[model samples]
Target: MVERLRGDWPALEHVLVIGEPSWDEFITTPWEDVRDPAVLPALRPDPNDVTLLIFTSGTTGEPKGVMHTHNTMVAANDPLPERLGTTPDSVFHMASTLAHLTGFLYGARLNVQNGATCVLQDVWDPVEFVDLVERHGITCTSAATPFLHDILRVPDLAERDLSSLTRFCCMGAPIPSAVVRQARERLPGLAVLGGWGQTEEGLVTLGIPGDPEDKIVETDGHPWPNMEVRVVDREGEVVPPRTEGALQVRGPFLFVGYAERLELTRELMVPADDGRGDWFDTGDLAHLDEDGYLRITGRTKDVIIRGGENVPVAYVENVLYEHPAVEAVAVVAVPDPRLQERACACVVLKPGASGFEFAEMQAHLAEKGVAKQYWPERLEVLDELPRTPSGKIQKFQLRAQVVDGPAG
Candidate 1:
């Protein structure tokens, strides 16, 4: 970059670099306070002009740097709080990696946008998280279904003074209605919300404020203003409500393109004759309700989405982790015309724990309020969990075990 923009990119005003001893280090600026952790950019470009480059997780392949202009960031950040009823005083938290859009763009931006104190923790410790919330009066947090479950394990969480908490929202997994209800009852101060977003569109969908009791847990809220979402076929025409299709979103929050992968970018954003703008077809399948609420079903490529239901393989695997008798598990979908596809879960038991029953897991899921239909039909015990260097679960390796094989 220094070589490519040798003349165009002049000296920077202030640079705050986050130097992680192990993880990849990142450099960011544009703040008024110029420090190591926080940098102040020397040049003051117009908010609409400054370009922000954020990295994408790239579970599909290598990590991609996504480009976003300041105008794009502001457009995505501005209206979020009111939709979630967050305030300047609200201390936002998220366990998800900040490098990801949800944590980076939304969580970090909230601090700057509201002039609120931002808490940065390197790890997700439930005990420490609750302590920080109590210590700092954190009001809003974005997380996944598993994080909430772990927090609920804190004994008598309901009795704790979580009064400062205003918003408890999650993504990347389905939050069971029971979990949401329990959370609301446990943390009466919290307005429990289930949200859905992709790295591509910058986490734009949210559940409505004061949504119906069932709606909050059952569906990811609705689209934000100025975001045009279309459930389209290969031809790209809009589909009606309740019909699952490739979730195509074109809006201000859209990432410019995959960081350095130009070929992939071309395939993703190949525009029509009119030359309107980029339309990112988030591989995830989702549908909009009559009232415009968006609910994510499943990934378009990984597993076949039966009807409109999203059989979240990851969500189910996370649930298995909550079982005391279980050690590790991976849920994968197998092709089945009758059900579109049926799920099979592979598990590894604790050293001493044995006689792990498939029926028992079904009962466990039932008790936990996981939809019965979403339960795995077959179960296989594995020796260990396959993971990447980053410790992320490798679903592809798990998927290979079930291919051309009998269930379980």
Candidate 2:
């Protein structure tokens, strides 16, 4: 993996390899060098200068390097610790890769900002997570929703002491209400908060402490301080409350731009009309309730149109997650000769579960009161859903598998 990474970027200068005995072609640093503490001076850099070059998850296409200035990075971390109740005494845990925004911003940066203790895990294991919670008194965590789901499925969960955990901020993807309910039942002391953001914009909305369960499960969350979100029509006009439209964000937490993609960045930025700064098109379909809570329905490209009727893919997937047999689900648009497009639900069943049938799927949707038009016409059970390294579902890959053949 290290060799592949090196090959991707050929601008060679110096390579530092730790823990290896020796690499003849590179500088082999000893483990002692990494472990030993050294006195270092704090060097202040320009806040407006770019400091972070993270990449998008690229669920739909090729990944792009997202540029972030020091000002944006600092601003992104400022409101998080307060909202999450993180303190100097709190112990944080992070299992996601630090390269991703969730891990880098919330796991590493937020812990530093709060001056709290953090336990980093290179790999995700639910059994290990429970043990760490007991050993380290881990009080808080911010990760993808699937991490929370896996934690709920861990065997010997009832025997573990997880009282130290309080806040679990689930981001990267929509939180299934079923998974949240399971967490509530299993970890009564833990608060499962759903959030929405991307590499382009650091956590713009998050559920706060003491929020009602409806807000915890149904809506993503309220906007963070200095972050503004609005739903606009295709013409860029603000839509009324509870109306689904493209989501836009204007905030200090927004990234500077995609590295070397200035024209693409400008194309997504909507010029300011009300004296406020320009709004960045989020490429998400969502609706805001009158209370200002954001509920993301689906990605604009992920929405399935059937017989001129739109199917909310995320909504249907959430309902399917309520099924006991379903471990993970992704609803993608399948080509249809007559309707132009149809919804096909690709699911991964829980271990040792009996086979699921199309009738059973439709029955469950009916029981959930989902509109008939929104019901997925077909169901495909796979061993597992394709996911990015950060656990976001690769729906584009799923679509290719469902429509054409298995993705290479």
Model 1 superposed RMSD (Cα): 6.9
Q: How many steric overlaps are in each model, in order? A: 5, 0
* Model 2 lDDT per residue over 221-335, tens place: 9999999999999888999999999999998999889999999999999999798789999899999998999999999889888989889888899999999999999999889
Best candidate according to TM-score: 2
lDDT of 1 by residue, 1-408 (tens): 645666665775333434653223223433344554433354458666637776655444456677787878878887787787766776777666677667776567777987766677568778888888888888878776657867877766765677787887776556656567667777766787777776666766788768887678657878888887778766777789988778887878877776668888788874656566767778877788888888776666555355556676646765787787775566776766666777888887756786688889889999879987788888887777565332344566667657755655
Off by over 4 Å in 1: 1-43, 46-50, 270-276, 305-330, 334-342, 346-356, 360-377, 381-394, 400-408
Taking all chains together, each candidate's TM-score versus the true structure is 0.74, 0.90
lDDT of each: 0.71, 0.89
The runs of at least 3 residues in candidate 2 whose Cα sits more than 4 Å from the true structure, single-residue gaps closed, are: 1-44, 406-408
